[model samples]
Target: MTANLSTPPAIPAGTLPAGTLAAAPQPRLPAPGGLLLRPWAAADATVFLAAYRDPEIGHWHTRQPASADQVREWFDRYGADWAREKGAHWAVTGGGGEVLGRIALRGIDLDDGVAVCAYWVLQAARGAGVASRALTAVSAWALGGAGFHRLELDHSTRNRASCRVAAKAGFLLEGVKRSAAVHSDGRHDMHLHARVRDDGPPA
Candidate 1:
């Protein structure tokens, strides 16, 4: 889901412990061409809410349709995560700061020193390489800045678009976890993918 920066509570340093899979410095990066990957801000709530309300963006992930108040609450919870440096959320935008979608490095397993990544793009932004670029930007940051040696991403077996995004972001197909995801409709198989630190940039 796209994160709202106005959510408050900036990510703090050293909040994560030094362990095999705990906190590590991630690499910083410049925004991709034709796109910007910026830290989320609270003022972005309207754009975020609009994106979420789009059924195309909302249906694939676990997020249910949300109201404006619900969106605010979501940002608050995400802010708490950021404050601890346990994860990060970014707003994917156009050159002039038009919100296109949301991307995040979440589900950090501090003990394992790894994290899972997820992203979504607005319907209009689809097929424009927005997702691929965002994924690359975040992946670089995760591996370089966070000292995280490994990253994971997964998509439902039927979600070809997501699977493609994962691959375009440099994640290698690990395998499938049969009947692992319980979607709104029912359970479904999941395709797991991983990217080691040494993997080259997302193609």
Candidate 2:
């Protein structure tokens, strides 16, 4: 009796794909309705400061920028994060390069294929579906192009506007995390909204 012990062809390792899992590059993702998702730049400090002045913005994102110097520092960190494949943040802009808002996919978890989405539109752009548009575009790209399986977005239940944006973006409301977050105003019960790879067509 004889037995055969043959070695199989070696599989490729460490040849990961780009635009997924690990941040490689921020691809140009388009947000229809006259919007573009571009990487944040140092020159955007002024616009960011302007947005930061909005009451809703200040109330929601406690870290209100006090000076252009602070903004530049934040910009530097954002750049480093992208280069290190840590996270992706983008400026929601218009045709003339006017900054309207910000959108980001941060806190990425490769093990669970999860990432948290954060976004805000300036006061001038509110009620125009800007956040929803940007969120939908970014989330789709993150799932389809970036290879992330699940995207999560949370907002203080008190932020009715953010809830609307999340709902319009097709992120299914996934209940709440009681006293899970502290906002500028106070502690909040965070409403967790999420979308998965198999969630099907975006709404």
In angstroms, how far off is 1's CA in candidate 1?
54
Native RMSD of candidate 1 (Å): 10.2
Error of 1 at 135 (Å): 0.5
So what's the TM-score on candidate 2?
0.87
Q: How would you encode candidate 2's per-residue C-alpha lDDT over 56-79 as one tens digit per residue?
A: 788888877889899999888887
Model 1 regions more than 4 Å off: 1-29
Best by TM-score: 2
Q: How accurate locally, in lDDT, is each candidate? A: 0.75, 0.82
| lDDT of candidate 1 over 1-203, digit per residue (tens) | 98887797743432335442223322224557877777666788777878866776666666653666776777777766666666777788898778887788897766555888888998888998888888888788667765566789888898998988888888999999999987767888999999977786766
Cα lDDT of candidate 2 equals 0.82
Question: Count of backbone clashes for each model?
Answer: 17, 0
Worst 10 residues of 2 by lDDT: 11-20
